[model samples]
Structure formats: structure tokens, C-alpha cells
Target: MKKLFFLPILFLLFACNGNAQKKSSDKAEEKFEVTKTEQEWKEELTEAEFQVLRKAATERPYSSELNDITEAGVFVCAACGNELYRSEHKFDSGTGWPSFDRAIEGGVAYGSDSKLGYQRNEVHCARCGGHLGHVFDDGPRETTGKRHCINGVAMDFIPDDTK
Candidate 1:
């Protein structure tokens, strides 16, 4: 009957609503040291930077200028200048993005990212909560064995001994 059809639709709607509420609460629990309005972020970042950092959009593979960087430095968050990773931890993951074996202490935070259907670890700046990239397990076993695959556009490198 019509009642049976409505029951399944109602259940589906209720389940989806519950999931959305949980996700929103999960985000609320994460408090960043730096907060800004959407306009503020847009004004400060370039178009590509805004798209990746604020909107969590991934840049095209191999499109980042920082992918080939080999200098000694620290990578800072493009939005708030928070030091997120050290040059020593960076490696070539061959995924066309800058890959780091580990993040600097207290610089980045890891969260569950279910955007791609299955859950993955998402790396973001702890200061401003700007999207940096995701982490995966297929990294060099000699080190942490965790690959912190990051967006080059989301970072600004400040070399050691900048003098």
C-alpha cells in the first residue's frame, strides 16, 4: 500500500538527517586557535588557495609548484602561517603532491574524512582549520609509515636560515 512506500522513504530521510547532525556536532567539537569569516579568508587567499584551503577542494595532481621543492624549510599554513611540517619529514610519494612522513608537533590535526565514501584521515591546520590534505598508510616503512599527503597550494615554505 501507499503507507508501506511512505515508511521506507521516511526511514531513509531520518537516517540521513541523523548522520548530518552527527557530522555537524563532530565539527563543532573541533575548536581552532584561529577563526575567520568567509570573506576574510577569501580576501587573504588566492583563488586556487581559497578553493583548496577553505573549500577543501583538492588541486590537480602535479599542478603544485612545491612538489619539486628540496630545500630545508618549514611548511606553513597558507591561511594563518602556522608551521605544519618540517622539510626533513617530506618525501616524494609519487602521487604528484607534497608528501610528508610526519607533521610538526601541535601544528596539524587529523580528522575522519568520509568525503570519498570510505573514511580516510584528513590533515588540516590546527591554527585555522584550513584544509591541507589527507593521510594514507602506504608510505615508507622506515619512517612513520604514514603518508601525510598535502596540497602545495595550502602551504607556504619558509626556509631555515632565511637570512
Candidate 2:
């Protein structure tokens, strides 16, 4: 009886340890590994892109150039040109900013953003760590309840040329 109990306990410990290590590795990978300086990002991004991607600025609602864009294409990071969102996932959130129910797989990530003391998830470009915007739980129920509220300056819409 003692041997059986010890075996299960040992198994449980190993399982938990494995889970912890896996979570750590996943976190490390979720974070962008780029080491570009601010000046480098600034030089690479336009003035508006720098404001949104580097300073975490928010563009006014309903003011995005891509808000009305309906052509099928990929939306890429304006700062680093990283593919972030698919045009198919883009949707109207009635919040003014460009909203998406999902992102290209592994193209973006969320981190704790406390700049406003509200503990929101700060969205970033997975390829470059450039700030995109905050994500909210209030989204269309037809898909993920996560709304990727992106600043227009952080993304460039590419219309599909296949048409």
C-alpha cells in the first residue's frame, strides 16, 4: 500500500514539474526575441507608426484608413511589416478602432499592460514586439470573445490582388 501511494505521488510531482517547465518555455517563445533599439524602431516606422507602435498611442475611433477596407488581404505590422491579422478575421466592433476577432496564428500576443492602472492586455506584434493595442473581452460571440483593438497606424492593409 505504501509503495503504491508513493508511486502516485511521485508521478504527480513529475507531472506538475513538467507542466511548469512547459509553461515557462511557452512564455519565452510567446515573447518576441528582437533586440532592436527605440531609435531603430523609430527609423523603421513612420511618424504615426512610431507613435502607435512605440509610444502605445491610441488612434481615435472610426478614424482608421482600413476601417472601411473590405478587400481580402493580410494586415501587416506597419512598423516591422510582420503579418499580424488576416482580412477575413477583421470585423466591425463599433468601437472606432480596427477590430479583429482573431489573428494569424502566432502573429500577435497579449501581455499585462498597466499603463492605465486597469490591468488590460497589451497586444503586440509577435515578430517584433511592437505595440499594437489592447484586447478586450467584449467581442462578437460568433467567434472568440477577444477583440484585438488595433491602432490603425500599427497596421497596413494589403488588398488581395487575385481578384
Number of the top-ranking candidate, with lDDT as the measure: 1
Question: What residue runs in model 1 are displaced by over 4 Å at the alpha carbon?
Answer: 1-21
TM-score of predicted structure 2: 0.76
* Alpha carbon deviation, residue 27, candidate 1 (Å): 3.7
For each candidate in turn, the TM-score is 0.87, 0.76
**Cα deviation in Å at residue 141, candidate 2?**
0.5
lDDT over C-alpha atoms for residue 34 of model 1: 92
TM-score top scorer: 1
Off by over 4 Å in 2: 1-34
| Clash pairs detected, candidate 1 | none
Candidate 1 per-residue C-alpha lDDT over 47-90 given as tens digits, one digit per residue, 9 for 90 to 100: 99999998889999999988988999999999999999999899
Give the number of colliding residue pairs in candidate 1: 0
lDDT of each: 0.88, 0.80
Q: Scored by Cα lDDT, where does model 1 land?
A: 0.88
